[model samples]
Target: MFAIAVRFDLHDTAAAERFDELVALTVPGIRAEEPGTLVYTPHQVRDEPLARLFYEVYRDEQAHAAHEARPATAAFLEQVRGLTRQLRVELLADLPS
Candidate 1:
């Protein structure tokens, strides 16, 4: 499986609501369109109010590539452009079970 863990700090707490709204729109669209997407989970950090995280898992490299090519992905990226103070993403390869 292929996965990615994304973490970010927002520019301000006020941006959190807009961020949530975009995620809500983006996740459902991805789920419906991408059969190879195994998981797409979004989290809001409780203690760090402006922090957000997303854990995404795909069936394989091709699946992940396809996901990035989706329109929803572009829209989501655009929405986050000015809202984040810091952003980091880690691409992952799951170890054998």
Candidate 2:
């Protein structure tokens, strides 16, 4: 799997709310269109009112590329541009199972 975890620090609580809403809007398209996207989940960080987290898992590198190439993904990126203060993205690797 090609996976990633992202931590988004919103500019303020209000921005967090807007960001969450945008995430809700964006997810359905991902669910319906992204067959290779095994999981794409968003979380409100505990005790951090202005923080959001996302965990995304794709079938492979090509799947990740396809997801990023979508117009909806571009729109979502544009929508969230000013809402976040900072974002940290970590590319994840599978562990021995």
Clashing pairs in 2: none
lDDT by residue (1-97, candidate 2, tens digit) is 8999999999987898899889988999999999999999999889989988999999998999999999999999888889988989999987889
lDDT of 2 at 47: 91
> Residue 4 in candidate 2 has what lDDT?
96
**For model 1, what is the error of residue 79's alpha carbon versus the real structure, in angstroms, after optimal superposition?**
1.4
How does candidate 2 fare on TM-score? 0.95
Clashes of 1: 0
Misplaced by over 4 Å in model 2 are none
Q: What's the CA RMSD of model 2 in angstroms?
A: 0.9
Best-fitting candidate, scored by TM-score? 2
Each prediction's TM-score versus the true structure: 0.92, 0.95
